[model samples]
Target: MGILALQGAFIEHTKMLHRLGVDSFEIRQKKDLLLPMDGIILPGGESTTMFKLLNDLDMTTTIKELIQNGLPTFGTCAGMLLLAKTVDNYHSDFLGTMNIAVKKNAYGRQLGSFRTTGTFASTQNVPFVFIRAPHVTEYGDTVEVLSIVNDKIVAVREHNQLATAFHPELTTDTSIHQYFIDMCQQ
Candidate 1:
């Protein structure tokens, strides 16, 4: 597994994957993309900065190619924004591979961050940490709603791509990570 280490809460994702006995490394530079990876995690952070850094390192094209070519991807928060086909009131050249329309920080600002135990599809009552989360307001025909909280879509899966508006790594939950691992194995 590979975690985009340009910025954000990537370390937590690294630790979460480690707990699941999954080996993961950081993708900080364009050369890092050369490494063999079964899947990639785009952790929560500042999307604009991450996008800028990706272009500065000239890594966006290769990463997008990898994801577009059917590599499994799990994006959380800002990662969701990057993977989104359209982010309301925002634009960038990041990985717009997922066929979902995301509302930028749909849950509001950092002060609005909160936590809740919600149903994530079959994985019922999973712990969700919403820190300036961006719930999927709409998705294409192929996209599946994996979870929802207060009627807001928090998790979605589209083909080989998976995205969550909340941070699963911030909590003790390992099922979400396991779900992504299963995706990689498939």
Candidate 2:
């Protein structure tokens, strides 16, 4: 697995992958994209900054193409914003591979951050940590809604793409990460 380490809680994800005994590396520049990777993780962080860095580093196209070509991917929080086709406050899309419309900061700002347990897919009582998270307002027919909180869409799976508005990496639970790994294996 290759984790985007440009910003956000990437280290937490690294630790989670490690706990699962999965070898992982960080993708920091265009050259890093050449490395073999069965899957990728876009960590939660500032969407705008990460987008800017991706473009500035000339890695935007390559990474986008990889995901579009069926590279198993898991994105959290701002990472979800990056994969979304339409973001509420943004004029344009980022990556735009996942057919989902997201409302940026739907849970309010950082001060509004909180933790809760929610039902995720077939899993029960999954830990969800939301921090300036963006919830899905709409999704395409192929998209599978996995989890919802307070009536807001917080998790979904579309083909090889898995996204969540909450930070599963921030919690001790490895089920979500394991789910992503399972996607990669297939």
TM-score of each: 0.97, 0.98
lDDT of each: 0.91, 0.95
List clashing residue pairs in candidate 1: none
- Candidate 1 lDDT at 126 equals 94
Candidate 2 residues 1-186, lDDT tens each? 999999999999999999999999999999998899999999999999999999999999999999998999999998999999999877865888899999999978889999999988899999999999999999999999999999999999999999999999999999999999999999
For model 1, how does the per-residue alpha-carbon lDDT over 120-175 read when each residue is reduced to its tens digit?
A: 76978799999988878789999999998998888999999999999999999999
The Cα RMSD of model 1 versus the native structure comes to: 0.9
lDDT of 1 at 55: 91
Best by lDDT: 2
What RMSD, rounded to one decimal, does every model reach?
0.9, 0.7
Cα shift from native, residue 135, model 2 (Å): 0.1
lDDT of 2: 0.95
